[model samples]
Target: MTVLVSAAIDEDVEFERVWLDDASWVDVARGWLVGPDAVHSALLDRARWRQNKLWRYDHWVEEPRMGAPARHGFGEPLHPVIPKLHRALEHRFGVALSGPGVALYRDGNDGVAFHRDRDLRWLDDTLIAIVSLGQRRPWHLRPGANRFAHDLQNKGATHDISPASGDLLVMGGRCQVGWEHSVPHVRHPIGPRISLQWRWTSRRGHPVRGPSYRAPRNFSR
Candidate 1:
């Protein structure tokens, strides 16, 4: 049997629906990358050895958190196919990204809670590109109000994106600031899924500090 594949498009030209009237959330833009299946498989293979994290909230009154691995700088070469895909998005949105590609693996009950990617040290007002691969799941986006209130009154809409084998999601502008997003766990049996998130950071040339490196003792203490 022959499998039908869909094409990816840039955000500007793709069909979109606003989730929250007050936020910059949009949905239903299909395949925005080389191919979701191809990228998904690649990320799954890479993540087999790489570690993953559970998202956390720092404070009681903090916003919902989505844990992600530290950004991996571009000093390491990216898969050749990724550059072409990245460039396509950059041209579409007219924004240049920096370095460190992020890949996420959600298996079993693993899921990402509602949140935004605005707090990165190097992140500015730029678009964050995401390519989805594997089993289809729901991605939710909502306005960022008081944590409690937002979680309560925020009937924030959701997009049950069935991003089959290959699909992409590009979020930008006030989207990051005005809204929060997430990939909730599904009850259906889902095979391993991989998502590649591309973004640029301002802190490129910074040095690395090992875990053993201790801070200087505070004499005042």
Candidate 2:
């Protein structure tokens, strides 16, 4: 297990930006690309061939209400560059990540419905890092009301994140607790987008699954 530090942000624009100049609450952070483009290109090349699964609507044990299009992972021993980014995130947050990271790709109008990533044991009220590559898309987040109301409500505090090639978004603490996030389907043609979601889990092994479906042990509301 390797320990890493976090990077410092010199500008506020890197932290918060309002969409449409509205103050409803759409916060985003973008990290600068540090190395050669070749590294990212290579990773994308390999990811295209990796196995992925489409999350079935009926199979998910929890939060079966929304869509879980596709999901995949990058196994043990992350790429060499990942540790450096992990270290920078740790330094920025003043805490260390507790487990291995995974990468997922969503394409063809596929997306994750409204939900939160708040079940990891190692997470313990910390942040999860998401890096976007390839094409840009809109990522939305809103407040979670009652179960019945949440399923019906589409307008809450929302953030439309248009992450360009090689951009990073970190959601933590209150952000994950009070809000639910999703990447809705786009009507226009969009190229495949790869997201590297860095998270900490207590489990030791990784299992392959469909694009939308996660392993039963890892599934939660």
Candidate 3:
């Protein structure tokens, strides 16, 4: 697996466009940031992490990891790295990437199941940027819904992106509507992973569904 990821990195580390289907696609940039490990360490030490949960069938279920949308909602000024990353993304993609959704996968047991960015589906086209940090993990995508999984070989509709630290993956076009993606749960031992997601919104902004939190800096009355 490492070899495969390495080969992709060697072949292209900047703006390599990959077509997942006729409508959805992704842009992969390996090692886009310098010293991603250090950035991960800093985030672990400073970012205000929060537990997440989902409302399903009139009941609540805990998410597999701790996360927060710190880069949105005017909650607080983001870490210095956030601004730097925003600038880089704007320059590379020429789009205003906003509304961060950061997730910390503590280990193999912690991961998100297959799903789409349904919240951003209001538009015809959208972009979602993900900056991977710490520990490489297989990120998979499959067309339509609920068909992305390990037993995806026979389905012939699944593909994966194993991103190393500092790597960037951008899902664009009708990806949210036409494809489902996942970071399947692992049983074996593995290191932690932090996914920095900067998703799209209107030029102004919009409301999102999900449990909210008050950051460490919250001072509202």
Candidate 4:
């Protein structure tokens, strides 16, 4: 449940800021993990991943990725790299973080579609940090569509982020609510990629905002 970062952390870690529209921001940090190859291999063995279907267009569709969640709290043992990664981010961001799960993309067909993280809508402010491993794919983000700003979904305008092994990518501020991020399907061959989402769990006790939401028309590229 609680993540700890030891003082003898690696010194090679460095962060780069990428600013986006309407004050949104993304932080990319590289060289945080001492041995990324070992970590990635460990995940492949230790993380018991599963795949599910998502309800879209009133039909059940494959979720496009396999995930192995570590439950809500830190009651059980996690893969070796998770806690260390969280602690590193905690030291840098100065806040406690919780990772609900990691999404594993096996290949080009495995990926997430366009959708804002609903958890962010529950909080006024929070952060979602992702630590990447294995493969490099385009993680895209763009402004959420509204009745008047439907043109904002233009594919040419999406922010394309490619995080390699041992890299940390953080999305904070109002980014989750104001913008949508996704890992698009690649057209060519590529190795597997693992993305660990370290997020602040939304207040579970907050009242529901309203009825469930539907993705905007043309939300897909």
The candidate, 3 or 4, that scores higher on lDDT is 3
When 1 and 3 are scored with lDDT, the better candidate is 3
TM-score for predicted model 3 compared with the true structure: 0.76
- Where in model 1 is the C-alpha error above 4 Å? 1-19, 46-48, 52-79, 121-124, 146-162, 200-221
On TM-score, the candidate that comes out on top is 4
What RMSD does each model have against the real structure?
8.2, 9.2, 8.7, 6.2
Q: Which stretches of candidate 3 lie over 4 Å from their true place?
A: 1-13, 69-79, 145-151, 154-157, 201-221
Candidate 1 overall Cα lDDT vs. reference? 0.52
**Tens digit of lDDT per residue, candidate 3, span 1-221?**
01111111222445779997786789988887767777677666656789876665456677789986554336543355666677777777678877567789999889766667765635347789998989898787777754634365624346789889989999987777677778877778999899888877442333344433221222246
lDDT of 4 by residue, 114-149 (tens): 666674446435689887878878888876654235
TM-score of each: 0.62, 0.61, 0.76, 0.77
Model 2: weakest 10-residue lDDT segment is 63-72
Winner on lDDT between 2 and 3 is 3
Model 3 lowest lDDT segment of ten? 1-10
Model 4 segments beyond 4 Å from truth?
A: 1-9, 71-78, 145-156, 201-221
Q: Score residue 132 of candidate 3 by CA lDDT.
A: 91
**lDDT (CA) for every model shown?**
0.52, 0.52, 0.71, 0.69
| Higher-scoring candidate on TM-score, 1 or 2 | 1
TM-score for candidate 4, residues paired by index? 0.77
Best candidate according to lDDT: 3
